[model samples]
Target: MPVYRPSEGCIHIDALSCLRNTGITIYNSAEPRRDSLEVSVRTSRPSCQLIERIESILYSVFQVCWLEPEQTAGKVKPFFYTQGQAVLNRSFFPCADTPSVKITYSATIKVPHGLVAVMSASQWHEPSADGEFRFTMDKPIPSYLIALAIGDLESAEIGPRCDILIMPPSFPFGGMENPCLTFVTPCLLAGDHSLVDVLIHEISHSWFGNLVTNADWGEFWLNEGFTMYAQRRITTMIFGHAYMCLEAATGRALLRQHIDTTGEEHPLNKLRVKIEPGVDPDDTYNETPYEKGFCFVSYLAHLVGDQKRFDDFLKAYVEKFKFQSVVAEDMLNFYLGYFPELKQQDVANKPGLEFEHWLNVPGWPRFLPDLSPGDELMKPANDLANLWSSPEVDLEKVKQIDISLWKTYQTVYFLDRLLEKSPLPSGNMVLLEKTYPKVSKTKNSELRLRWTQIIGKQKYTLPIYRALWASSETARKLALSTFQDTKKQLHINVQNYVSKILM
Candidate 1:
């Protein structure tokens, strides 16, 4: 009998076992199989005494018994974590790539004598004499969850359980890192540690996603939506409720911009969208599952009418379904069962706003969280924004409010409001630059990105957004010349985006 981790499908479970063990590992999951020249193979592992025979019962899958690995060389090099979005892990490993099944993986990765290796796993053993690092992930996670990186890495204690691994933006391979070492943009390091929210985001996933999970791509919101909700709950506690609301207000702007761009009817906007065969599930990703799903979850809290009670339900929900893959209905069923009174009242079947409608609906979220709590913070930014965006003059009022005094998100929210109200009288540009030099000079990526966007978009009418050079004649020549001098320093993505604006 072959040792297999339990997965929903027969192919997934069997193929997974044959893919990772010492005895007859499956490899080369790419290129389709050639016409079946009759072949039979039995895999065995000594400890488990696991054996399996896969016969001619086959679809097309190229399974290489001897693994082929990608190689690279460097005197002093870094290999950042690898995770192809969605289920593209097969490009690097021959493992079965499906979220429907979670796999537990253990690997002994060899590196240069002095280098370090890390995998996004629970346990790590010190490097052995032979320069091999061992890692074990007892948790069953979707294939994409496994990540590995080997480098001359160093670590610092960030928290009791958290360790900081810094990689400069110049690290070419540091595209996107997750898991054990959790790689992130260098920009998030504001020196003051104020912008490490992405770390909080990944940590939240430990419960809502890594623990319990979505069964398929269609229900990905269960992972991200819940994570977003969880992330804010944490922020609300660490910061005040007002700050959380202020920060969320910025997120709402992003969600709205995304919806407008994608056209609300796009299928990806649905909380549970269909993933057609052959289309990569990663391609279906958007803000819908995140912001819209957060709204839905937040609505549930609203229905309960007690923040404490809703939080208790969330805790109970995690307890009920940890370590399982489930669809939207599973969550709904569990929710209704947990709150019998709400179930009796038929809250889900409410008119014009049924839970089913929320799951299937497109466009704007039916319910928006009351962000008024942030108004205490938002009113200042809004007032500042109106002053800059206003046709008449109020430059004096804008100068009175210190931009530096505002927190990072407060600054971010102010800029986002400006973007929403772009095409200000060109005169406002002078006042803005003169009043808030930080907008042009700040090192904060979030603020810098927003400022650049305002410069890029302030003049172009909506749907025909263009760069600062296109409309702001005062900033045009200088912005273009600045690009000529510094564009090469920008990342390729930034270069292309800025290039588009200048064009």
Candidate 2:
């Protein structure tokens, strides 16, 4: 959509895409690239056509419990998921869709008698008896953050001020960060509570992205990176530091793999990237901003020699910039202002400590978060994996190891390490499934994902196929990858069965 300044007037639109009798007079401002327009019509009705595009604000119905026909008695419950990002918000209403503009908004929506509606604003858990819901956001947020969903929804409290919005079992992504109500996939209700980290990540956005904002799409990391770091901190508070470190290490590995695939010099890998004209901001989306940004911020905290000091700095930065948008340089300058000594020649001279190169250069930085805390916990898993790889190790002794002492993440680390090495013998594989019955039965999606990969790679067709069929409707990325890998190695009948199930 073209950028234009609106005068103190309102124009009625019958349609958005096509302008039939609509006429507007342009009043060019003296300032370059800044113009104002005025439009008025005396007709009893005025309208504009709806603009059609490949992707825009979407309003569609999805069926829940479709796979469980017997349990649900072939009943189809419909729900809606709205995706309004980039310029899609403009398709729904008149507004600039860029991150440069922030606005406070209010909405009142009327839904079906039995359905509820939610938005990215302060919300009431219960709708009015008449099925009308009202919301207001006091904090100014960019248009992309504006969201809406309507359905037969339920809510559960997870924290003091945080509540999880339970959607139909078939909803895709692990979760979506709407302001007050966070939408989560039904698979998370697997009962293990392992997927609660998804909720933590979304909760952290309240401070990192919602209160302190990014100036533009190019500095998108400011929103996500800070949120990732804060999410880890919250995770640490809830699940101990070892759990936090394990998650960070997992993210680091992902970042490295992304860098390897995208190339070290790729612009998308940079902490601060420039978007060429006509390029969709969504095209540049990846884990770089989330993980790399966390790495840089974590590295800075470690460099300062005190995590508390870094925490204090973050608080100060947010206090100063709350409700305002900023660029990457603004964040760097804030750090310099907070810790004036960092700008000194001696400090700046330190290797890999240069701010400019760290922010602008693409690829992994010279330093990463100290994963030693997690690596120490992983040592037992690593040693066990090594023993399993050797021919002389007795399978009986391998099964005797006290894996019950290990946490879910440690077990995952051990399993992942084993997968990286030579394939385990069939006997050892059988022993593994029997030894840690919980790993096979666990509802933790992360652990299940890693274990499923091992099962797929070992060509353990039956279990892998069963895992796929049982988990297929959840729509997890790792689950999808496992489905593809296992399908390749299974019998034709099994493959056909999986194909039908997935479809």
Best by lDDT: 1
- Sliding window of 10 residues with minimal summed lDDT for model 1: 63-72
C-alpha lDDT (0 to 100) for residue 231 of candidate 1: 87
Q: Which candidate has the highest TM-score of all?
A: 1
lDDT of candidate 2 over 1-503, digit per residue (tens) = 22222672333233323233454322211211111112322333324332333122223222321222122212344455555444445534545566677888987878887766778787454568899888888778877678777766555555677756765543435676767767776667767566677788888888887778877777878888898999998888888887889877767766876798789999988888787665667655678998988987887777677888989999999999888889987887788778877766445446666777777888887778777877777777888888877766666667767788877667767877877774676577777777679888877767776777776542234445555556535534555677676443333445565666555
Q: Where does candidate 1 clash, by residue pair?
A: 120-180, 423-458
Model 1: how far is 455 from its true place, Å?
A: 0.9
Residue 270 of model 1 has an lDDT of 90
